[model samples]
Target: MSQKRLLLWVFHSFTLIAGIQFLQYYIFYNSSYPFPYTANLVNSFGTFYTYLLLLPLVFYSAKSAFSNLENRVQRMLLLVLSGLLVSMLHLFVMHFVNWLQIYQWTEDPFWNSYRFLISKWLHFELIAYFLFVLAWRFLVFEKKGSEASKPEYWTQIKVKEAGLVSFVPVEEIRWIEAYDNYIKVRTKKDKFHLVRMPLREIEAKLDSGHFKRIHRSTIVAIREVVAIHQDNGQYRVLLEDNSTLKLSRTFKKSIEDSIRV
Candidate 1:
């Protein structure tokens, strides 16, 4: 991904988490407690705990939506199921801890009371599950909106008939070598087509997760980078195939930043 996009996704993730907390707090506080301001704050605390405890849910939901789930139904199902499971686990632990307190202190406040614990837990489970659904919807909407807003040039690829040829999958491409007006996409299997597209144009067509510009005429795939070695203060990516590609010092950090592992 471009540096700008990576930063945007990070910001979006935080915003979604905060938004969920606010909305869930509003719903729970209004329904379960009578106080306006104070109950709202308490609800916020609950949502905070929910966010902290359910961090995996947020990550998985994003991963499922972006990388795995192909349909909206599956995405929503995963989000809801994961959300409910995480919430129930938190609720059980909270109630169990409260039970330990009640045994030691001999207090009864319905807040932690066991009289209708099952029903109350179920209620909160529904609420937490709804929060996850809201998050899923938000991500889907954001993706659609982003797609709609992209410039036409980014999605439209120029067609040039290159007589019975095969191209590489965007994922398998490690780098592209640009010479004059033609760029060669290098993959694990072999060097593919020599297209007349500019490196920038081809980069736009490829998946950002797999390809990134490391120099004016070079782009590298993070997955294929086996090692980053320095030679006389210059950086180079040693690939899985034992091939080495030079990384320009100017864009070295940007390339390094995109490597997830």
Candidate 2:
């Protein structure tokens, strides 16, 4: 995540925590709660402040633990582990702060307080972790959907061949072939240009509807496909230049759909 985004989350979380704690304290103060006003206020403020101090660690760990995890079981395990670690850290810091306030860092009383706090706050801490993860996932999903809906207009691709630089217009390109650590750009005029870039990287820059990957080694422009021939359960893509390229069974359906559309 970018520093700006991290800072924005921190600010928003702080505001949310503060607002909730304030309302909670106000409700308790007005109600017939048994707890003393001073003690209630102290605990409320302490809990909120403790979470504010731990926000960075929690956010960083949650992002690292949940991001890119595809397995459901493994992701759940990591989430539980991360939540436990964050809760333990929060408990330790809260106790240390309390000890500082009382000027007593003794062992027995600290352990007792720690146990009590854990028993009372553990479930809440886990819930907080899940809530944060849900919000982060929602934001990411929305960002991806917004990007996918935007139109892509690629004009040209810059290519360097033999120490000479040139710009190839997107429409003139007929097909592209993958070479080891590079790609061979083929134009409609039957000219070939070598570019030192991966075909997958180049593919991402092209219009998705216009260019389709027919095989691991070939990506053909949809407009340049003259015909598709199938024989013996295999397919051949015939391009406008009369060049035949093998169409992998994996991408055959996608290529056919794009052409049909």
Which tens-of-lDDT digit does each residue in 1-261 have in candidate 1? 332353356456656776677677677666664445544553445434544555556555656665677898887777677666676666666565545534335556545464466566767666755655455446554566577787542322333445654444565666788979888766677755577878887877666766677778888877887778899888888888888888888878877787744
Model 1 CA deviation exceeding 4 Å by range:
1-144, 150-162
Which residue pairs of candidate 2 clash? Answer: none
Clashing pairs in 1: none
Instruction: Give the candidate number with the greatest TM-score.
Output: 2
lDDT of 2 by residue, 79-170 (tens): 78887888788777777766565526356587787888889988988887677666655665446546777877667889897788999998
Report lDDT per candidate.
0.64, 0.77
Give per-residue lDDT, candidate 1, residue 58.
58
Cα shift from native, residue 194, model 1 (Å): 1.0
RMSD of 2: 7.1
Candidate 2 displacement at residue 98 in angstroms:
5.2
User: How does model 1 fare in lDDT?
Assistant: 0.64
